[model samples]
Target: MSANFKVLTEDSQFQSELSEAGGRLVVADFTSARCGPCQRIAPLFEEMANKFPTAVFLKIDVNQCTSAAASQGVSATPTFIFYRNKTKLDTLQGADPETLEARIRQHYGDGEGEEIEDSGVPGHIDLIPMINKAGCECLNESDDHPFIQALTSAGGYLESDTDEQLILYLSFNQAVKLHSMKVKGPAENGPKDMKLFINQPHTIDFDSAESANAVQEIALTAKDLEGELIPLKYVKLQNVMNLTVFVKNNQNDSETTQISYIQIIGSPVQTTKMSDFKRVTGKKGESH
Candidate 1:
């Protein structure tokens, strides 16, 4: 009903709006009329549209315009497709408010805009660089599908060339409390089972990954891959200098598994004593 969100009943308007978006960010919510999650995320999406005036937001009912959804590779209800410069950047599967808000903030502002308040506890920060710098190697690694792209590029990702399994060994510069995580990629090739190991000292081979007891193991569904923040065991993750992750399988048991984005959010463990530094101050009105 309002211009903040345009509800499209057909494909022509969809194409026109996308064209008009040009180089700006466009968020398309491919939703179905009967989807409960679609209804739940509508308000949040609309609020984002109102908050970010520069971005284009559109709501398209997949049931009404099947062809439109097909064109965008949207096979499920409530698939959020982000576009910039008229090109697709990412796809979020379900109603994941945290990841959606983060993506919006990532492209919309350069940290100069007003900050959004999180719950009493501070929202976690990205820990990929720390892992990368600490050194990481994946199982069944390939040159064409490098791990760096998945870590660095927005559209690039790491994929196994031969099998469904991928184990990564990551070391951190400092200790950190692992909090929530988000995994996203193609529905079929995405991870279905995952295991986390804390404080691992060496590379974990396939045999070791199978035999070793993981600190945390999770079975992920389509919903989990849809930008939802999957929180880990906070107490267990404290003082984690190194970590290991194993992708056991895919949802469809595909031959090759792929992961476009893997985001770990948490804060670094404070090891320094704050009282060590003495406060030095000048008179309020005195000039140096």
Candidate 2:
């Protein structure tokens, strides 16, 4: 029961450490100090490590420990890997919090071998949803995005097993890429900025210039939103119902023109009124 982090120098050392992990769990976080996305999610894994102190928590710096990283096939920062009884269970290659969390949950389950925790939702954050509905009027963006019927609440969601994409053609005062993709969220007086979390579960406020988000910050108006805007952009999804898309009015704004509705239509991506979403989904007059 140790949340210990060790830097491996060679493949043999890494193997020895893995075997030493016993029957507990091994969480290998392959990261470097220079990775912005790694910095964003480092806190999340830290929190999980802390939450389950009985496991082996390691932070392998890919830059310094070349041999170990190369052996593990880790060329990127913030790669989370799992091993049970020295056997690899799951591997998360990107900085996608939702995807990472999903993989971790799958590996950890309720307990490792014998230990058990009664907490229903273990080591996962509850993020608000932006578009909370089932079967949006918007057409299916990917084979992954589907209407989740067993959710505690229905919303625009993608199954954890799916690597699908959904494009949200909405207008924001500012738009930036989380890593390299173009995505938009509430800017100006719209809503609180999304947080970049990892091990310790931290948040980068809308105004803060943090090491999170690898790509340069660009201003994407309605015209800038291209490709499929993933639901994972909003929530750190693990389960099908884990994705949330809720937009509440900013209390500080005096303008009555908050977000009336969230719509996705037309080429590339288009921002339409909420009425269209409700009319299309037959959810008119209902609040998210």
Candidate 3:
């Protein structure tokens, strides 16, 4: 076993390892001493442990830790499970070396592995500098924890004043192709059940935002609140000049929604102007 690989003998140890993993990818191998396939793949598993230093590699002997195996539904030996942010991503049975390596690469590759699907849109940048600060407003937000603080300053946060809901209206200096957004806060109070609108002429209220059609709606998970970039609908946000984010509720149904940090990721769109086009006169010709 490599230095990164750990052999778990107790259920408590298994749970502790997962808790410590936090947002990192964890690959757990459930095997038995008697399993022939497990022995064959042990070398490759150790190699992967060494290769992917950022990930957590764990081995749990089913016979030694029966409770741990049962909790993870590892009825068959040589079962491999992948987890991230305390969520089960995938499970693979049998010890096919090719399949095992592919699964590892899919989650955490050598250099190019990514959790988000490739949106094909390029030139993504932080759009904070382009924000029209004067045009931005957050309804139902506490005065102490203002919207500007959460949007601009580090470690600053915004909290709801009245209820769990919050409505944020933000306009930009130029049109942008919005790719994704990141919202960070406490898992319990972080925004969930979010609705996004684009190019709204006026600030949206709770009732109107709920009834009106939204470009996209998302139910945020705990992992999402951990500063993960949530991808937006590329087609709908291609030409967005203004954006409205509505927090319909929060995780755990908290009394107030709170956001510590928010980042908009996309590229600015360059529109053509009629003035840029010059009318060319035909050179003085003898005949038309």
What are the lDDT figures for the candidates, one per model? 0.70, 0.40, 0.77
Candidate 3 local lDDT, 1-288, one digit each (tens):
676689888878988997687646789998877888888988888889888877889998877876677667666768888765454556888889889987776555223222322223243555665577778999999989989877753468999998999999988876777889888889988998999999998998899999998999998998999888799998878889999999999998989999997888775564222234343233211111
Ranking by lDDT: 3, 1, 2
Please provide, for model 1 over 1-288, each residue's C-alpha lDDT reduced to its tens digit, 9 standing for 90 to 100.
Answer: 335467789977888897676645678998876788888999888888877776778988876776676667665668888764444545778789888887666455332222221212243455553453427778775668866656543567888878889887767665777887778778888889999998876887899998889999988888887767787898888888888889999889999888877777665564222233233233111112
* Higher-lDDT candidate of 2 and 3: 3
TM-score of 3: 0.52
lDDT of 2 at 224: 27
CA lDDT for candidate 3: 0.77
Question: Least accurate stretch of 10 residues (summed lDDT) in model 2?
Answer: 265-274
Model 1, residue 77: displacement in angstroms?
55
Better of 1 and 2 by lDDT: 1
Model 3 lDDT-worst window of ten: 279-288
What are the models' TM-scores?
Answer: 0.53, 0.36, 0.52
Enumerate clash totals for all models, in the order shown.
Answer: 0, 27, 0
